[model samples]
Target: MTHASKTTTKLAEEYATPIFDHLTGHDDALYIPLLNHAQSQGDVSPVINLVRNEENFPYAIAHPLTGIICLLAVAESAYWVPIDRIAHSESCSSCAPIWRDLKNRVRTLKPGETFYAAATTHSPMGETRILIDAEDLEN
Candidate 1:
């Protein structure tokens, strides 16, 4: 299996926090299937490619799934954008929290430490969490 698929399956099977439960809620039914489809058909890359081709693509950065995907793309060094676009954009309001969270994660990284993007989970109410695995950086 691909790394994304392994990560998706791990998240689907291993984690069960209340936050995850709440975020998933009803959409839990669709999350795994969509994740599988994205992995199988490589849908994630097209979304990231759009971001690469157009940094200011209207709602691309603000929609939860796409936003988290963009964040993970950046995290994995697959996409690049100016710091201003990530931090100061009113156009990406829905993604503001993610930007802030990314900054926070970076701030906590120790010397010789690195991180890897794992997966994104889309909630029923249109929220997203970009999973990162600092422990799996070597992989």
Candidate 2:
């Protein structure tokens, strides 16, 4: 790989709390810092408020490129919480469309390009967590 490809993104360095054996849909990801690495400066913007706290509903950081969630940013800010501290499973069938769409967009984007991401879950209502969207970065 080229040196640029080997270089990690700033987002992963600042956020991305690595995980071990956390279930995922993609390759053997030590974690989805790949999502952050995939992210570019000023790329992500929250679509909804993912609150992080005991009292609130659960949310996680997901990326279609990795096809898994590695970070949980909720309640206040993005990637503000260390993902390892949260308990989350791999991607579910319900959220497959999100991943599929993200993967499709990957075809067009140059490496190190930007994407938007977010995560929110409400099992009772059947809402799925999502992350990674190069095509929908503006939304």
Candidate 3:
């Protein structure tokens, strides 16, 4: 894992603000059940594997934007998943509707739009940051 670079942090704040606001504004009660469900099923290895192997994940981009979205969502909600767990589990189907919903919303970002994401290790000693521009999606 690596820390968020300056560029990544700036772009992430710019792009993720609206999305995070939208998610947080909703009735949080609706997400409690799903959060609880994900908590109970603690195994997230599969999702981690996919994140590490971007080629295996269809939505791969220059940045781990999806993981960042997942991190933000979990942070704002009652989702018990840790940041590290959620970062890797962005593609985890068993997680909940919120993860998928966030991913879908992120996918809708228009061309030229850009964002940054940082996946930090549990120790907080390191993190990996990615800068995702819409153009990266074209490849």
Model 1: lDDT to the true structure: 0.32
Q: Note the clash tally of each candidate.
A: 0, 8, 3
lDDT rank order: 2, 3, 1
Better of 1 and 3 by lDDT: 3
Query: Each model's TM-score, in the order given?
Result: 0.27, 0.31, 0.23
Residues 15-102 of candidate 1 have per-residue lDDT tens digits of: 2232223322332111111111223344321222112223533122322222222222332223322111233222344435534554
Please tell me which model should have the higher TM-score, number 1 or number 3. Answer: 1
Which stretches in model 2 have alpha-carbon errors above 4 Å?
Answer: 1-34, 37-51, 54-91, 117-139
Evaluation by lDDT, superior candidate among 2 and 3:
2
Residue range 22-79, candidate 3, lDDT tens digits: 4334333213222222233553222221122234321222234333443312222112
TM-score, structure 2 vs. true: 0.31
lDDT of each: 0.32, 0.37, 0.33
Candidate of highest TM-score: 2
